[model samples]
Target: MYSLTNNQLYSMPKAVRIFASSALSLGLTASLIFYPSASQAGKNDTGVPAELQGEWRYGRISSIQYQDSYTGQSAAPNGSSDQFQLASNGNYKRNRLLQINTYNCASNLFIEEKGKVKIEAQRLTFQPSDSTSKGQICNSGRTYSSRNTAKPETYQWSIETNEYGQQVLVLETADGKGKAHYGRPQ
Candidate 1:
């Protein structure tokens, strides 16, 4: 516990001081990074709409696109350019990026999945057209393959304008385990 006053802490042994300071520093950093600020807590928005099709980008990386979340909300800001090529031919290819924010560093991990997609009424079904690999890509410690494309992952999706006025495609995974939001980078 940091019960010692600043004066007392300064008088403590060097080893004790270093350990305590390191622990405190790490805890504070973690809290600050994860604590949602007022503007980030949540904003008023029209929920996912019933129609979402065509192409969308995460930000500006023409090669990078779509992101996934358990809430189906926009994971990135309104300026991301994640690309999604949704075609009427029931074929699609999109990049999924997972941001690892830690170690005083930020890294983007992505995997591209391609397959056949069908949007009927309110249901969106996907049948992977490529079974070779999901294409594992990591911009970090090591390259790892993503198991996201082992089989078809379907979702019920809709389009909506967020509070920031960006058109977003929101979806919930088939297993009810994750929700994701997609939008055109402004």
Candidate 2:
């Protein structure tokens, strides 16, 4: 077996480097690393694994706390929820909603997308057939809507056990800047 130094490993392409680092850290072989059946679930004919087929939802709330002149300390809250339906044959639909409330004003956005998906080397790629987006601000009475066809989007995907001891699907953007955790509806 050959060994790679940090310098050599860091010189690889981003995806390769990520794969290599994960494989090395987990002591997994290349073949075992990307095979869903080895760790999570079995794959179907289209390479969309069984674990990924079904309804999954993600929700998160974020708050910013700051000192206020009159209130001493206050928090501004925002949150988002996303739902995905993945079919056995590599078809998918997604609905996402986001809301922000602060200073007696509220803003909301809703997005829907449908597409075909494929899994390769732990990466999930979505080829969107259609998409729609709408947004509104309550206080300003401003609203907007748009419909567009999106290009293919890809993300690294994995299955993990969440704090509740349930299997969750995790997807991260290629740059690792955006991540979402999806779980089966309770």
Candidate 3:
């Protein structure tokens, strides 16, 4: 019968360890060469999909100047600039004015409008507000006692792989009215 000491049994030859490690590494490499990792295995299963869940600075509206031909006068001659910000926490603010010019002699004016919006997935709903409007020349103005002016708006958004292997976000309004392209921040 053959007997081995504890140290002898526990200790392994350096060459044997090296050969074993090399074989194991080679096996792993071969497996990787043949079969992809779980992450690279399937389409639409690229893990949790990217969402439009972040703070976004959607540019700015500037140079909103208007002039009327009949009066040969400028109402908002200096014009104004404003910003729009959207957040993932279902919160949005448009600290700006939507300029709608009659492009006529009467030259009505609308100013100081602000509102909040909520966003979910691809859908967006805006809290309604009073439609307060004013007439410049005629000195006639009225405030509509209404909460929501229009319907709750919804849209579709998507994340796509770009040419650089990076993900991008594409947004389209529900009514097919507007579309926007965006990319992840650096």
Candidate 4:
């Protein structure tokens, strides 16, 4: 019932038209990315494994905590907490809080990401839901990969019990450049 005439669209300001077009494209893309297609919606729901369903947390952890990464080395030294929550419906979320402790002050920086994930043959694959910028700052737009920027990060995961007898979520990057250990939250 609703339609836009070519003349009317052409009459709008160029910037307005571009913005509207971009907005519509982004909305369509988001919907397609986040929703399952008709043929795959409900026939079989292959969710993540049971032991990996709850919340897994890291940081505030000692250098000697869980097995570092797949290589068994400790992760980089940083003041941050990483939490991962894998739901029953294959939906997953990860929240990272970085604390910058200066000589006399402290600031908190946080980033959140969500997507659908599933386990197959003992391996967990994350389909990241990040679709935008990594920072909210006005000028620099410094990446969120550090203490001051908003960075979008990703990882592959697994369930493991550390030497300390605690359940841990082992996460590593696809290239093996990054690794982390998140213990079962107490």
> Which regions of candidate 1 deviate over 4 angstroms?
1-51, 58-82, 104-108, 131-142, 145-149, 175-177
Which is the leading candidate under lDDT?
Answer: 2
Candidate 2 colliding pairs, count: 0
Residue 59 lDDT, candidate 3, scale 0-100: 24
lDDT of 1 by residue, 1-186 (tens): 011235434644454444334423311100111121122122113221223446765432222233445545333321112356766555777664434232232334344668777654456665566532221122235343434333555576555556665556655555544444566555
Cand. 1 TM to true fold: 0.47
**CA RMSD of each candidate after superposition:** 18.0, 11.9, 29.8, 16.7
Clashing residue pairs in candidate 2 are none
Model 4, 74-175: lDDT tens digits are 333325566778888888777755433223222334556677775655456656565221222212332333222223334566555555655566666555
How do the residues 1-186 of candidate 3 rate in per-residue lDDT, one tens digit apiece? Answer: 011122322343443233222222211000111121123122222122225444332222224455676778765432222233444333444332222233432222232223445544344444424223222332233222222232333456555554666555444555554454455556
Question: How would you order the candidates by TM-score, starting with the best?
Answer: 2, 4, 1, 3
Where's the lowest-lDDT run of ten residues in candidate 1?
28-37
How does residue 108 of candidate 3 score in lDDT? 25
Give me the candidate number with maximum TM-score.
2
Cα lDDT, all candidates: 0.43, 0.65, 0.34, 0.47
The CA root-mean-square deviation of candidate 4, after full C-alpha superposition on the true structure, stands at 16.7
